[model samples]
Structures are given as structure tokens and as C-alpha cells.
Target: MKYFLLTTLVSLAFLTSCRTLQNTQKPSAGAAHQSQEQQYKAAVVSKAQTAQCVTAKINMDVDADGKQISCGGSLKMKRDDVIQLSLTFLGFEVGRLEFTPKDVLVVDRIHRQYSRASYAEVDFLHQAGLDFYALQSLFWNEIFTPGSRDVRSQLNRFRLAASGDYTSLLLTDAPKLNYQFLTRTSSALLDRVTVDGKTAADQGQFVWKYDNFTTLGGKLFPTSMAVSISGMGKKAGFTLALSRLNNDTDWPTRTTISSKYTQIKATSLLDKLAGMAQ
Candidate 1:
């Protein structure tokens, strides 16, 4: 059941970078002045392109099945390299998750245990073709293709068009996963992203919604995000409201598990996370 903490932290990080949507109700972007591709590029993390790091203090609430947990945490991220997030419950540390290009390091402060896994070692992540860098892109407010880091080259795969109150970016017949991103037609700000696919352990449909925009360091940034992840047997997800963000400066680059903590196998960890441990 404690694996719940790990998954929650992991999912929360994926939901943050995409939250920079500025909530404006301008006049429907004037009938798509540019091509869909142009609109996508324009809508992505604009002023954030020059950023090498980011940090934010946020409040989170997560629900898995009928179980729910609420906590406050901080997100400290270094572009393309690592993300360090620490969760606290009433001023006490409860969990920590760090994502690097090579592995995910999780620390269960409540239980005093820790685990580490490469993308290939985590069955769900492996089957979904999700990696640390790809996750980082999503956190950085840029769209991503699992296993691909260059969003610039991958833009051609998406077909863009206006759909009612929103402009949509669609990837059909994808080799691994189908993806969709919706933006408000009025402001062209990203509203959400959808990921549909099956992992080794289950089929998954994930949606991330962005809102409550604010200006941080002179650039528009998202202050709130909601994540919904539903799989075959269960549903788990969370919502975040960021109270602070530092768009400049790097954070801790490595997650070092102490020798005092018990080391466990990656598969065993996943079983516990899925509540399949016997």
C-alpha cells in the first residue's frame, strides 16, 4: 500500500510542467490565423525555452480507488537531467522521488525504505515507453512523444485543427501511443493532454489538465494542474495547485539512497504498488 506514495509523486511531477496555461477568454484566436503547427509551437512553453531549471511549491490531493491522500510538496527540476520532489505532511517529510535520465529513485520517508529502477526495469513505464526525459518535457510545459526527446522533429506527426471551443493536436495511428492535446480556442493556451495505451500490467488512459495561469519571472506559468489516470482494474490520480515557482536556477541533480535503507527489486516494488503483493 505504501507504493501509493511513490506513484503519487511520480504522477504529480508529470502533471506539473504542463500547467503554465494562461486562462484568458479572448476572441477565439481570430479564426486560426496561422497553421495548426504554428499554433502548437506558439502555445508551447514560450518564454520557458531559455530556462535551465525550475522549482515550485505546491499543494496536492490524490485519490486511488476510494483512498485519498493530501499533502504539500516542492518540485525542483533541472532541464533534461533530473527532478527532485519532496512531500511533506504537516511539516514532516513523508516521501521523496527523484527522476534522472537513467533511473527513478524513490524514498519512502514514512516507512524508511527506498527503491531504484531504470525505465526498462519498471514494467508499466517500459511497456508505455515512458522515460525520465520524456516526463521532464511534460513537466517543462512542452509536448512529448514517449522515447523521443526532440519535440521539434516530432511536431510533424501531429495534425492540428479547430474543434468547437478548442484547438486540438492529434496523433492517429501512432506506433506506440495515441496522444491528444487541447487548447482553448480563444487564447490558444493548452488545456490538457491525453495519453491512451496499454502497459505490461494494464491498459491506461491518462489526462492532464492545466489552468489558473500566473506570471512568474516575467513569463506566463500555470498555477494549477489536474491529473486523471484510469487503468483497467482501477483508477488513480491527483490535482495540484502551485503556490510558488522559480523559473531560474538548478536543483539537486542526484538522488542518493542511503546504505541504511533496504534495497528491493523493481518488479517486487511494482507488485506492491499495484496492490498485487502477496
Candidate 2:
């Protein structure tokens, strides 16, 4: 159940990055001209190509079947470069996972468990239905970067628009997740994103507010976020407070895994699981 909650939260985070906008009255001529001017200014000054490093604290709240569980953790990330994450649950350190463009590592500090894999593991995780990459993109500064071709294809499924000093993209296919991206007129760094997933059909919606941004190494990153998931039956919310951001630092060079769980052995385990399912 915990893993299910983690996956759901991460997937929601991904959808939040591609939030949809609401319908508004058409703008006057003067307002339209002002919007074009702002877009031009944003194109000229937006930090679209810079890289950055960041660290954050995340608090998660899971509500299911009338029961609730809460957990907290920290993350360190480099934009389009690397990411290291450590999560704690129930007062026990869960594990530390790291991702470079070329490699992946999982270190269980408490149990002295570790695992390493090549970039192929990224796809493997995706196939395993894990949203690790999505989570990393949220914490890092690369969420504003153009999404993958596949992601673009999915986004094209919706209609998007722009509002005052911010682009308001709208998604109509999934009513349960209304997505929007609020960006400064002069930057790609999103200022605020409003997600309204409620309508006459759905009972309620979730809203996540991001703020406390600071520039580091020529890129901007958020230091705090408040997520509120509300519905009629089960409503859950929590705040993710971040601190201690470090730039251009390397995590552990090598991770030691148990001899019984080397790369070859892990692959064998995966293969056995696949065979059993067949």
C-alpha cells in the first residue's frame, strides 16, 4: 500500500507539471497587445538553457480506506545532470536512490542494502511502473524544459492557453486532473500552478502551491510547496518544506550491494519474475 501511494503521488506530480487551465472571457485588444509584449519579454529573458542544483524536503500524506499515513524525506538534485534522494517512513530510513545520466544506485543505509544499474535501469523502472524519473524532474529545475516527444504527444491531447504573465495550458481529456502551468512573463520557471479537478461530476479537486524560489547557478528552483488533495470521500494534504541546497556536488562514487544481489543476479531475478507471470 505504501508503494502504491508513492507511485500515485509521483504520477500526480508529473501531471501537475503539465497542469491545465480554465476557460476565461476573451481579452480586449489592449489586453491582447500587452500579452504579446509580455511574451516577447519572456522569450528574451527566460532562463531556458541554464542548469542548476537543488535540495529539498518532502512530506507525504497518504489516505486510503479511512486510514492515513505520513512520511518525510530529503532530496538533492542537479538539473539535467544528477539526483540523489533519501526517504524516511515510519521513523525508519527507507533508502537512498541516485541517478546520473549514465548510472543508477540504490543504497539502503539502514539495512546496508545497495543496488546499481546502468542507464537501461531507467527504462526498466519505467516498465516496472515506477515514477522515479517523474519525481526527480519535479524536484530538479528541468521540469520547464521541453518534455519528451512522447510527453508532447500526450500533451497535444489537450488545448492550452496563456494568461497574464503566465501560460495557462488546459487539459480536457482527464477531468479528475486539471493541469496548468503558471510561468513568469520573462522566464520559463513556473511561478504558480493551479490544479482544479472538480466539476459537477467530480466531488472536489486538489490544489498545489509552489513558492519561495531562489536562483542558484543561473537557474531558479522552488524551496517550498503545499499540496492539498481534496475530494468528498477522502481528503488529504501536506506541505513539502525544502532546505540545504548544494550545487555541483557529487554523491557517493560507489555503492556496495550484497554479493547475492549483483547486477547479473538482479537481472536473473527480474527474468524469473517475468517467466512466472507468463
Q: Residue 244 CA error for candidate 2 (Å)?
A: 2.0
Cα lDDT of model 1 by residue, 1-278, tens digit: 35458558545433321212222232234446446456555565353546677788989888766568888988888888888877888887788888888888888876778878897887777765668876776565557666677766776566566669987666554556667777677766678887764234325667878888777666666788888866535566888788878875844477666777887788766766645211
Top of the candidates by lDDT: 1
lDDT of 2: 0.49
Regions of model 2 farther than 4 Å from truth: 1-21, 24-49, 56-73, 80-83, 88-92, 96-137, 141-177, 184-189, 196-199, 252-278
Per-model C-alpha RMSD: 6.0, 7.5
Give lDDT: candidate 1, residue 74. Answer: 89
| lDDT agreement with native, every candidate | 0.68, 0.49
Write down the RMSD of candidate 1 (Cα, Å): 6.0
- Writing each residue's lDDT as its tens digit, candidate 2 over 1-278 gives 33423333333423332233356434335868657645543442354325455555666554433345666776766655566656687666665557765565655455454555664454444342324444454454223222232233343343335567665444445534455555555455655545554355544454566678766665666777765545434445555667655464555433456665434344542343233222
Candidate 1 displacement at residue 181 in angstroms: 0.9
